[model samples]
Target: MLKKVRVQIVTDRFEAKGSLYETPAGKLLPTPLQDMPAKEDIEHMEMTVEASYHDDGDRVCIRYKESELSGMEGSVTSVSFRKSEPALISMLRDGSVKTALVFEPAARHLCVYQTQIMPFEVCIYTRSVKNCIEENGTLEMDYTVELRGAQAEHTAFSMRVLPVFDKPISK
Candidate 1:
């Protein structure tokens, strides 16, 4: 039977690489494809996680402080992971992998200031869950999110989750 457990996440490293999209007309375009809240924004963030397992998959909801994000919106991120393989799993995020396509008239005279947002299909990968076990032991996993070209960029992060056990009080 699947059970619920409370764990704490120790964020080891979180960062996003900067990218520059060079146009055919030799122009550099920049976007919010970088990680927000700078590295020095937080000394260290440890968020409490509530995870539950179901028949088909498992779900985890994480809550953190808005101060950690600095200027970013929201403080909760829910992650869905499916357990199919014995040693590996995937983290799913739908409609997240998206890109902006420049049409004919738009790309003809496109400038950094005059950029338009368009809907285009971008590929999203279900990153494998590493360093995790199916048993009731210490679970450690690496979260990787790599999406480019005009959407929010979420870099990879590794966290260690240790189940907290409560001790009975003496009567």
Candidate 2:
């Protein structure tokens, strides 16, 4: 069955400035990273958006859009989760930036990140995945992103899905 749902997402991202010194565009950040103290940045985001949810008793799929609130406007995201000893989760995004990412505990996978200017390969190291979307309507994941062979960022994300219920008629 297909259902309309409200999906709430909270994501925390950490990045190291040293990794930004040289990107595909070249020399994006300050040079002489060794001379300067390693700088790190952390970002937190929370958003609630409408989504479509489908569960066929074996697998669950959720599709939503990246709105201005999430800072990735013009993007459509879909996540497929399968239940197992350790749940398997895969996410695909299409729009300005496109990528298909897989999350499996203690696994490393490479995927190409396509952007407006260019496309490059990135490595994803998944630390953990907790999928409770079927039991408690929640999902959690932790992973590190390596860009150009440099450990650039780590992200911890959690999401909760709530089915949309019809309101009662006012008396």
lDDT of 1 by residue, 77-127 (tens): 333333543333333222322222121211222222111344333322222
Query: Which residue ranges in model 2 land beyond 4 Å of their true spot?
Result: 16-40, 84-86, 149-151, 165-171
Kindly list the per-residue Cα lDDT of model 2 for residues 95-165, writing each as its tens digit.
97687888888666777778889888877667678888887889999776766866577778999997663
Report the Cα lDDT for candidate 2: 0.74
Best by lDDT: 2
Model 1, position 69: C-alpha lDDT score: 33
Scored by TM-score, the top model is 2
lDDT of each: 0.35, 0.74
lDDT, candidate 1, at 13: 40
The segments of candidate 1 whose C-alpha lies over 4 angstroms from its true place after superposition are 13-44, 55-88, 92-129, 136-146, 150-171
Pairs of residues clashing in candidate 2: none
